[model samples]
Target: MGKYDLLAKDIIKKVGGKDNILSLVHCVTRLRFQLKDESLADDEALKQTEGIITVMRSSGQYQVVIGNHVPQVFADVCRIANISSEKEGGQKKMSFREKSLDLISGIMMPAIGILCACGMLKGLNSILSYLGLYSNEDGIYILLNAIGDSIFYFFPVVIGYNTAKKIEMNPFLGLIIGAALCYPTINGVDVPLFGHVINATYTSTLLPVILIVAIAKPLEKFFNRVIPDMVKTFITPMLVLLISVPLGYVVIGPLANMLSNGISQAVLSVYKISPIAAGFLVGGFWQVMIVFGVHIVLVVLCITNIISGTPDPILAFTTFVTFTTTGMVLAMWLKTKDKSLKQIALPAWISGFFGVTEPAIYGILLPRMKHFVISCLCGAVAGAATAALGLKYHTMAGMGLFEIPALLDPAQPGVSLVRAVIAAGISLVIGFVVSFITFKDEEPSQTKGEEIVSEKCKKEVIASPLSGKVKPLSQINDSAFSNETLGKGIAVTPSEGKVTAPFNGTVMMLFPTKHAIGFMSDQGCEVIIHIGMDTVRLDGKYFEAHVKEGDKVKKGDLLITFDIDAIEKEGYSLDTPVIVTNTNDYMDIIAMMESGSTVHCGDDLITIL
Candidate 1:
C-alpha cells in the first residue's frame, strides 16, 4: 500500500463507502466528488480525520478539502474506490466554458514544466549567439537548439497523449493521431472536400490534433458501445484510426485551415484600420486566442512580415503579454498565503523572465481568472504603447526575454529598443500592482487565524459543548486540530466529561468508537465535538453516547459523556475540539472568551458571523 492508501480507504468509508461516490476529480486543493447522496457522507468524521483541511458543499459537489496534496489523495481515492468513467456512469457533465478551460488545462499543464525548461535553454542559447559566444552553426549549439526546439515544433504529439488521458481514450492512439496529422502534409495530398482544398501543413500546429480528439472521443465511445466483445480490441482500433485519420484530413484539417485564415485576415483588417487599436486588442485578447489555438495564425503572420522586410508589429505587440504574465505571477507569489501556491508561483514567474510564460499562465493566472484579467489589461496597455511609439520588431529574434538583444543594433541601439523596454516595464508594473491588490484567494489569503471577528454577518453563537478552560486551536495537541486543517473554531479542555449540543441540530455522526460526535445545526452549521485525542483507539472505553446519528437535539442537550480522568490517565489528552467544520461558510468564527478562562456548560463559547 502507498502512504496515502490508509487515508484513502478511510475517506472512502467516511464518504459513505465506495458506493456513495458517483465520480471524483480534483482542482488545486479539494477532492471534488459527485456523491450519490451528500447526506450519507460523514462530514464530521472527514473534518476530524487527519490530512483533510475541511469539507465544502458547493455547486452540487461534495468537496473533501484536502490541502495541497489533493492530487495524490485523489489518485489513491480513485484507485481504492475502483472509480473510473465506466464505473461512475461516465465523468461528470460540465458546462461549455468549464469543459473548454478544463480541456486546455489538461492538455497544456502536463507539458508546461518541460516547455519552461526548454524555453529557458533556448533563451540562453539566443543570448550566447547574440554575444558571439557560440553561433547557431556550431555543432554543440545545433544539438542544444534541437533539444529546445523539439517540444514546440512537435507539441501536437505531446498534446495528443495528454488529450487522450483527459478524454479517457487510449494514449497510443492519441500519439498516432498526433503523428499522423503532422507526418502527412495535407497540402501535398490535394484532398477534395466540398470544393475546398485541404492544402495546409499540420506541422507545429495544435488545431488539428485538438479537433481530431474532440471528434474521436464520441466516435470512440460509439464504437466501444456497439462493437462486439469478441473482436472489440482489434476492430475498435482499426475503425477509429481509419475514420479519425480521414476526417482529420478532409474535414477537421480544412476547418483548422479555414479558422486560421479567417483569424489572420480579421487581424490584418484590424491592423489596417489602426495599428494602435490592433495592438490594444491583440494585447488583451491574444491569450484568449492562444487558449482556442488560433494565435498561431498571428505567429505565422509575424514571420511572414519579417521575411518580407517589414518589422513585425504583431509580434512586438504580443511581447508585452509575456512580461504581464510574469509580473502577475510575481504578485501571486508575494500575495498568496498558500504554501503550495507560493511554491508554484516562484518557478512559474522565474521562467517568465526567460520568456516562457506557459507555466505562469497555466499554473497561477488561468485558474484564478482575476490574475488573467490583470495580466491582459497590462498587456493591452503595453501593446498599445508599442504601436503608439512605433516600436516594431526590427528582425526575427529568439524566444522570451533574450529577444531584448535582437530588437537592438549591437553597434547602434536606438529609441526603438528604449521604447520597447519602457512599454514592457509599464506592463509588468501594472500587472503586479493591480493583481496583488485586487485578487482574493479561495481562503482568507492574509493573516493567521488569531482574532475572532468580522461584521459582515449577523451574530449567531455556539454554546459551550463542554465547560472547561477555553483554548485556541493553536494550543491543541493534535496537528490536525492545532493547524486548523480540519476547519476553524476554538478548543476546550473539559473539566466535565460531557458534550452537549452547541445548537439545535441533528447528530450527523456518532462515530462507532463512541468518542467523537458530529452535529449539524438546523441553521446549517456543522460542528464536530471530538471527545479526546487518540481516544478512539480505546475502543469506546470510558465513553457513552446519549444520542445516535440522525437524532435531532436541542441546544444544551447532553450528547456524549466520557470519563475525562480515565482517558487522561490512559495517556490521551482530553483537549476536545468543538470545530465549525464548515468554517468558510461564515465571515468569522469568534472565540467568545480568552484562552484559560473558566467556562461553564452552555456559555457562549463561539460566536459565528
Candidate 2:
C-alpha cells in the first residue's frame, strides 16, 4: 500500500517481467536495469508510463527515467519484485567503447561532486589567505585545507574501492591493496619481491590503482572458485591483497604511470603548439563532450597534470564557457515574449552563473540550435583571448564566476584576476549580443488583457471506460494520481475486467503488460486508463491488450481485458483510475458519476470544459 507500490509493479512488468531482470541499481534520477534479455523489454510502454520521464539504453544499461523520485521507486521495485540491487554475475557482453565509458563513468561520477566541493573550498581558502583575513598557519585554514586534500591524498583507496566494485571483485580487498600502496613504510622503499624492486608511492595517482583493481578481479575469481568455502573468506582476500599490491607496485603501477605521463605530455605538447588553438578547441567543444559523458577525460588529464607538476591551463582556458551560456540564457530571458520560455530561462541563467550549465544548455540554448552554436563560438573567442593573455590556474575548481578565486595567484597581485575578468566580459558581451540578435521565438503569442469569455461554456463528457463503482481520484492511495499530478480525474473499483474506449480517438500508449492505456479524445482531451493497482506484478498472467499504440477506436470499443477475481486474489486493489493527462489545456474538469454508484462502459463519468 506504499505510494509507489503500483508504479513499481507496473515498471517490473513492462521491463520484461521479474524473470528478465538480472540486476537493478539507481543513481540520482535513473533506474539502471540489467536484463537477461534486453530485447524482451517493452520500451514504448515504459516510456509512456505515468511516473517515468523517458527511457535510455546506454553503456549496456536499460535505464528508466524516473526523475528525482528514482530512489523511492527503486526501493519499491526491489521490494515488490524481490530482486537484489547488487551487481550480478554473468553480465551481457558490451562493446569495448561502451565498456570503457561505463567503467570510467562508474568510478568518477560518484566522487566528482565531492571533488568539486573540495576544490571550491580550497579556492575559498586561497581567497581568504590572499585577503589577509586568514594565514596558512591558522587552525581554521589548516582544517579547511586538510578537508580539501583528504580525497586526493587517499585517492587510491577511493578509486580502488569503486574500480573493484565496477570489475565485480572484492571491494575490501581492493581497499587493502590501495592502503598498502600508500602505507608510509612501504612507500618510497625498494622491496625485493619476485626478482623485482618495487618502490612506488600511490598517493594521489589515478591510473595505477585502477589498473591494480582491474587485474585483481580475475585473480580473486580464481581464488573464489578453488578455495573451500570455510577458508575462502580469509584466504581469498589475503591472496588478492598479497599478490595485487606487490605486482601493482612492481609492474602495473609503473606501466600505468608511464602511460598516464605520456598522455599528459602529449596534451601539454598540443597546448604548447598554439595555446589559442588549444583554448578554442577545448572551450568550443567542452559542452559537446559533456553531452557524450566524455568530459571526465579532460578532468582526469587535468588531475594528472597537477599531480605531475603544475596545474594545466586547459581548465583555466575553458572557464568562460559557463559564463557564455549564462549570458545566452539571460539574453533569451530578456528577448522572449513567451511566459513559459522566460520562466525556464531565468532560473537557467542563474544556475549558469554558478557553473551548472546543463539547465541553460538543455533547456534554453540547445533547443534553439543557433543559440547553442552562438554560445560555443563566444566561448571559443573568450578562451582564445584568455590564452593570449597567458592566464593560468594553480588548482582545478568550479568554473564561471566562482572560479575567480582559483585563478588568483598569491605570488602575483591582481594579474590573473584582471585577465579572468576581461575574458568573462568578452564572453558575456558576445553571447548576449549574438543570441539576442539571431534567436527568434517561433511559438505563437497569446495577447495579454484580451480574455475572450464564451457566453456559453461548452462541456464535453467522457464516458466510463470500465464497469465499476465510482470514486473520486482524491481518494486513491497513490499521490501521483490522488494529487492530480498527471491531471484531474476519477477512479473506479472494477466489477469486471473489460475496458472499453470512452470516446472515439487514437490510442496514444498501450502498456505491453495490458495494465494501462492512454488515449487522446477526438475532442482533444488526453486521458489514461490504469487498471488494477499493483496487478502488473502478475506479469500479464491475467491481463490482455486488445489494441496497441496508434490504433483508432470508437466509443465503447474494447481496448483491454483482465481477470478481476484473479487480480484481487493476489492482494491488489482493482481500483482503476481514469485521468485527464492534459488538464492544463482545459478550463476545468468535473466528475459526473456519483461516488459509490455503479457505472457501465459508455456512461458519462466526467465532464471537461
Candidate 3:
C-alpha cells in the first residue's frame, strides 16, 4: 500500500486531483471512473502517467485500461478519494449485446471450470451406470452426485454471488437468498396465488432463483436504508429474509420463471419454424453479442438444455459462426503477401480451430473492413443453410471445428455429418472468394504520394523498433491512437532485429516479463515499445539484451535484438507496438513522412509539443 502511494498521487494529479473524480468502480482488469468534468481532465496526460497503460472514453465512463494490476490501483484510488469502494447502483445504458456478454462472462468465468468438471463427472457417472460397473445406490455414485450436482442444484448460490458483485451488492446477502430458495419447506409449499398454483420446485429449476435474486436485491437496499444502523446488523437481514425472500418466492419467482420460460420456448419455436432464420440470427449476432458480455443468457439456456436433455438453438448456431471466422483467417492466409501477415494468420487458424476466435477476430480480420464484412456475410449465409438443412449440435463443448463430432446428434436424423461438412465447405469457399475479390494488393514500404509533406527540416528519425515495414498509426487497431494522446508514434513489423533506443533516455520501467520496455526522453516524453500480444511466452529466449534497469543508453544503441526466426518458429508474429508512453504531457504530436534507409539516428520519426 505504501509503495502504491506514488501511483495514487500521480493519478490524482494527472486527473486534476481528487476533486475531479465523481465516482469509481473496477472490474478485474480496469478502473472505470465517472468524472465531474471530463473537460478538466487531460486524458492523454493521464495515459502517460506512470502505471497507466491506456485511457479510453466510451459508454459514458472513463475506462483506464490497466492490464492486470488494476485492483491495486483501484484500491488506492478509493483510499485517496475517501469514497466507498462500492460503485453506486444505477441503470447502465449498454446495448443489448453489451449487457448480454457482460452478464455471460460474469456468470460463466467464475463457474465454467466447475461446469466442465461437473459435466465430466456426470458423464462418467452415466457411463458407469450404463455398464453396470456401479449402481446409483453405490456410495461412489452418491458422493459424486453431491460433488457434481451441487453446482447446478444450488445454482442460485453461485449466480447470486456473481450477480451481486456485478451490481455492486453485498455478496453475503445474495447467497442468503440463494440458500432460501433451496430451503426445503418453502420451495415445496404450493399455494394457488392469483391464477396459477405455485407448484414448481426450487431445485434444478431456474425461474424461481433468478427472479427472487433480481427482486431481492433492490429490496435489500431499501431495508438497509430504513433500518437503524445499531439494529440493522441483526434486524435488516431478518427483515429482508422475512419479506423479500418469501415475497420473491411466492410472486416474483413463479411469475418471472413463467415469463422467461415462455420467452425461451418462443425462441425455440421460431428456430423450429425456420432453422435458417435462427442460424442467421444466432450467427450474425453471436460474436457481436459475445463481445459485449451479454451472451450469458443464451449460455444459461444452453446449460439448461444440457441438464434437462432439452436443446437451445442459439448455442447450436455459435458453432457455425466460429467456423466462419476460421474460414476468414484461412482466406487471409491465402490472400496476403506480407510475410508477417501470414505468420499472424497461422496461429489464428489454430485458435479458431478450437473455438477461441477473440484472438483471430480482434487480431486478424476486424482490422480490415472488406475481410470482416465478407466473413460475417458468408457466416450468416452458411449458418442459415446449415439450419435450413436441419443440422443439430449434440453436446455443449467448445464451438469450433473440433467440436464437430460433439455437435453431431445421430438421433436427430434431421442432422448429419455430411450436412455439417457441406455447410463448412460452403462457408470457407464463399469467405475465400469474397476476400480474394476484395483484398487490397501489396504496396511498397512507403507510399510517396500519400506521405504527409512537412515544411520543417527533415531530422534524422530512426527506424521504429519493428522493422519489416511500417504502417500509418491510423491504419492500426483502435482509432484512439490517432487522437494524438499517445503522442506521435508509428506501427511497425521488425524484419530481422529487436527493438533498440531511437535516442538517449532513462529506462523508466522494464516489464517483469521483458516483452516490453518504457523510457523517458530528455524532453520528458515517455515512449513504450511492446513486441507483440502475449509475446511474454517467448521467455526471453531470443532476446539479446544490451541494457539493464536504470542504465542509460545513447542513440543508435541496441536495447534488444530478437531472434525473428525463433519467434516465428514458435508460431508468433513480430508486429511490435512502439508508442509514446507519455504523450499527454505534450500539446501536439506529428508523424513524419515514411522514408527509406537514408534516415539517421535521433531523427524525428514523430514530433511532440
Can you give the TM-score per candidate against the true fold? 0.50, 0.66, 0.57
How many steric clashes does model 2 contain? 0
Error of 2 at 227 (Å): 1.1
Candidate 3, residues 14-132, lDDT tens digits: the string is 55456556557665345666654343345767655756656655545566655345667777777876766644434334457545544555444556546655654654555466557
Q: How does candidate 2 score on lDDT?
A: 0.77
lDDT of 3: 0.63
Q: lDDT rank, highest first? A: 2, 1, 3
Q: Which segments of model 3 are wrong by more than 4 Å?
A: 1-149, 184-197, 226-228, 290-297, 300-309, 385-396, 399-440, 448-450, 453-609
- The parts of candidate 1 lying over 4 Å away from their true place are 1-90, 184-198, 226-230, 264-383, 386-420, 424-579, 582-609
lDDT of 2 by residue, 219-260 (tens): 899999999999999998889888887778888998998898
In order of TM-score, best first, we have 2, 3, 1
User: Which pairs, if any, clash in model 1?
Assistant: 355-400
Task: Give the better candidate number (1 or 2) by lDDT.
Answer: 2
Please report the candidate that would top TM-score against the real structure: 2
Best by lDDT: 2
lDDT of 1 by residue, 240-358 (tens): 98999887877787687567556556666777799999889888887776544345456556643432334567877887777878888898788778898988789778877766565
Query: What overall lDDT goes with each candidate model?
Result: 0.72, 0.77, 0.63
